[model samples]
Target: MTAPTPGTDGPSIRPRTAQHYSVAPVLDTPEGYVAPGMPGVPVTGYDPGTPTPHRRKPRRRTGLALLLAPLAALLAGLAYGCAPLRAADSLGWLTIAQAGLVSLPLGLLGGRNRLLPPLGALLSAGALLLGQLIQQLRLVHADTTTPRTLLQHTLTSWRADLRPLDLAFYAIALTGGFLLTRRTATRT
Candidate 1:
């Protein structure tokens, strides 16, 4: 049906009928939208159910306590190893990988306990050290023993690559892990 325009002299606006519409309307939702007074539904003064209050669903944590620490540590180590592959510069990249990807996420996901934060920090640091070991292993190209030639090269590379700044980054990552883990876990 057509209705007159309110203010201006213009063509009247027409309300759309079902025949004029091309698209099909949604009939039902996943929750099965039901109308009041339908069959078994209460017919007494139709009342729309109060909308549920919006709230963030609490994230599901890994159930096993025994597996949590080792898994976080291993994942942290693997994530650290991946950092070198992503960027040419190892300094800041490794720091971000350890603190951002590994420590922060793993710590938040790890069990909430007073002792867990310190443990997560230590584990993350240990894992990064293991990552350093992985780097040293990568330098050893030959699978078989190289009669001390390759071994010396590996050790030298490891020693030369480690700098005072890298040590500082390591400390930062450990502190970040402890702080982040402790902060989130303590909250309700």
Candidate 2:
């Protein structure tokens, strides 16, 4: 084999394959780099271009709460008025405690409305007053005393008949109802 001529092919020499590389686009801004057109993806910092999340409006339940409040107050009042009659005289404190506890639900249920607190308190007071009236009437009927004398005695001695602790219990129930309702209404 003599030396090949310049035009004649001897051993074929192949060229090396070219290498390829790629990189993501980088942006320099105060809000940091954010890919455009991607929804709900938060940028590193504050990006004015980014879409804000949608916020749903709170549901309005004030009307429904107002309607239910009086009914709840009535139930609470009935509970307070009847509890003492059902229990023995020695356990009067138990009745007071029950009345206070029972009234809590009324506050919790109706306190959502602005007017419910006062309404609940008024209903509770009325119930207690009615109970006293009924008790005095019963006493007058049982005794041989005249209605006028019994009424006068009951009215004059009403303060003595009502213990301070019982009043405190009623106050606590009313205040507790108002506070609880107010707190819940603000949160909504």
Candidate 3:
């Protein structure tokens, strides 16, 4: 009227429910299984009780900063060009206008690429230098009276001459935009 405990070697002589408790042979060994008090959690390489390290990403350039470069260029032109105007000369406006032209490209360059913005600025400045050279050449060749009239005439004479420079400007701007967009997406 009692069931016998199961065993691998032989059948138990005693009843199963009669013993207080018994561990299976499989659970008693340290082989193939963890004892639950091991160093770390089962799956992760670190303990759940400890904290992991944190990582930070690099910062990108701002649009406002880029726009300011152009504005500054305009102001610089105004400062130089307006000097004669301040003395009642029409030449100052021409100077201010020239400065503004130079600033515009520099600003666009700043907005495009962080690494290349300086180069863009330098190119704009170089273009301005070229403009100055052309203006001086007119004065020497025609015996022009004032830089203001010469500057205006120079502008009218070479209106289409700036087209190639404009193309170069746009190319730099487009390339910068593409690179910045790619860099931003990768960071995220």
- The clash count of every prediction, one per candidate, is 0, 0, 1
Q: Report the Cα lDDT for candidate 1.
A: 0.61
lDDT of 3 by residue, 1-188 (tens): 56554776578876556544477444466556665777652764768888777775434344554565445544543443334323422332233244344444344333334444444344345434453344434434485678787766766654644456544444443444334333333222
* CA lDDT, every model vs. true structure: 0.61, 0.54, 0.46
Number of the top-ranking candidate, with lDDT as the measure: 1
Better of 1 and 3 by TM-score: 1
Which pairs, if any, clash in model 1?
none
- Number of clashes found in candidate 3: 1
Clashes of 1: 0
Ranked by TM-score, the better of candidates 2 and 3 is 2
lDDT of 2 by residue, 147-172 (tens): 68878776755656778766765575
Q: Indicate the worst ten consecutive residues by lDDT in candidate 3.
A: 84-93
Q: Which residue pairs in model 3 clash with each other? A: 81-92
Best-performing candidate as measured by TM-score:
1
Would you give me the overall lDDT of model 2? 0.54
Clashing pairs in 2: none
